[model samples]
Target: MWRAIFRKKLFIAIMTAQFMIFAFDTTTRADDVSIGFLYTIPTLMGFLIIERGLQITIVVLSITLILTGCFFPVPIETDLLVFFANRVLSIITVLITGIMVNYRVRMEQTLGDALAKERKASAMQRAFVSMVSHEFRTPLTIIDGEAYRMGKVKQAVSPEDLQTRVKSIRQAVSRMIVLIERILYTSRAFDNKISMHLERVNLWTLLKSIGRQHSEVALSHQIKVNVHDLPVSIRADRNLVTYILDNLIGNAIKYSPEGSVVEVTGQTNGTMAVIAVRDQGIGIPEADLPNLFEPYYRGGNVAGISGSGVGLYLVETFVRMHGGRILVESVEGQGSVFTVQMPVAGAEPAPAVSTGESSFPDKQ
Candidate 1:
């Protein structure tokens, strides 16, 4: 803030000095003595103004002042030719100075932008490392705890208790597998190496399958699917579509309170297929809506939740890859509805690139 105030003051001072120079050249100078070149001082100072429009205005103003100064009185013995040449040279000097200043400003802006991106990438890398460490540790700790408990039991454990312990361990392992796959998919998406195997897929069947998978794991949350108006089939990459829905449904379950209903609805809008996942979760904050899909950006409200923050990023990326768009609506405490719309006939096939990974994993 202080820097901005100083810059504004400096700009005003420069403009004041510029006008004083023009006054001196037009009113106080003898005709033969050409000090029109002094206008270049203000033109050089224009580097302080980052706006291109303002820079161009300053250049034009300097040239105008130089030309106007030419009309003032001169000494009776002055050589008209020399005076005319001097004025032209002064104009050229100001123009060149303005050009150089503008070029320098542009270079500085570009360099600044590049540096900012590098800083943001570095910050995100640190966040990714921290998030992965925490996410992995939770499940590992759970698995270890279960094992330790079973081993310490002195009496014969009941079959039901043994089965329950095994289920807990398997769930922990499954959570780890999902985390690893999400990271892999995020990397592949960033590299633009995900290849689409486009085929005709039944929308209703796909939603039902994904709903079932999430339902089994998130037994506390009820999953509902309504697809009566949805297009029967869409030509798309089945696996990518599955990932998109899976992430959306999974997130809805993860963020919402226990026993909340997560409704998956679909409809047809002209040639586009529209699907929406509505969750009675802690809705996102208004400030986070715009950047919700940025990689590794979690909502400020989800402090204790276990998430790598790449789910929505990948969802949006995959949706766009299939030439679809996603939209979201939410209130702070009510809920969020994520809507996705895509052409029934999928996008043109992307150029095949080897991602060096197998197809999306099957549910365990």
Candidate 2:
């Protein structure tokens, strides 16, 4: 109950602060800036605790009243009303500021919790990937040595047996490489270390190329790969887009049952290109869907699936890097759709973006 009340107050206060900040301009400042300055000093000082905020507010406001006495020629009645109204405004602003500060603290605490969980999962994944690589690498090395040495043996090795073991080593190495790269890619994306090498590329052609790479995964699951229809062109970092799609399609196959459908759809809407990966895989929970794009956040139903949980994280980061948004629609136990919307280079948004108001002057 306490938390609920705090959140409601915080929301109202922050919104009000935002409204004031956006609305106040030097040209539009019908109210005196000194009054604005005095009113905000209290709220700023009062950010953390009601008691502390109120104390600082009072101190600052008192100083303002004293300073104005020396600088301005004011009548007694007008001065009284100004003091009364300013005091009321300061009280409201302080409460609002305290709420906003508290709400942010709560949000950060929640983010920390989620990050800690993800870190634990990543640690476990790192351990598993490490142990498996070490375990498999030893055997693979032995097999590879045996295969190479067999050719020099006085007794001839059956070409069939030699070929089989070599094939197994190759497969193991491929799996290890894939797991290692996925984790690494996720790390870079989360850290915002990915640098774009942007170029104008045909989206249809690109999808077709990436689609072919996943053909085997699709064939194994009896899922069709469709890239015949897509936006003809888009401007993006080609390699990043490829990585995004590869991870997305791989995950879809990894989660879906055999014979389930996996579809890739793309089209240009206004100034953005939307690429969606729709899968009839085990769906995500409604509650868990919001965190899907968070780094290392694995879905509840995907606990047993094969993933490092960085696919969607990298996907979202890459899309956002290009000035776009990603969205998801999923139903637990039904299926999931991951959508990537990328705005075209040099395109303007249709709607005017609105900013919030603050009592303080703009910092920049």
Q: Pick the candidate with the highest lDDT.
A: 1
Candidate 2 all-Cα RMSD:
12.4
**For all candidates, what are the clash counts?**
1, 9
TM per candidate:
0.81, 0.59
Candidate achieving the largest TM-score? 1
Q: For model 2, what is the alpha-carbon lDDT of residue 98?
A: 57
lDDT of 2 by residue, 1-364 (tens): 9997797577546644533442232112313435445446534533543443544554455445444443444444455555545545644565566567777876887999999989888785775565455545655676677667766778767889779777776766776566566666665555555556556767777777677767754676644555444567776666667767777777777788878777888777888788888888888888887778766567777654556556677777767766788888887777788887887662232232112221111111
Question: Which pairs clash (backbone N, Cα, C closer than 3 Å) in model 2?
Answer: 18-357, 20-357, 20-358, 21-357, 21-358, 22-356, 22-357, 22-358, 46-53
True lDDT of residue 162, candidate 2: 75
Specify the poorest-scoring 10-residue window by lDDT in model 2.
355-364
Q: Where is the poorest 10-residue window by lDDT in model 1? A: 26-35
C-alpha lDDT score of every prediction, in listed order: 0.82, 0.63
Report residue 359 deviation for candidate 1 (angstroms).
4.3
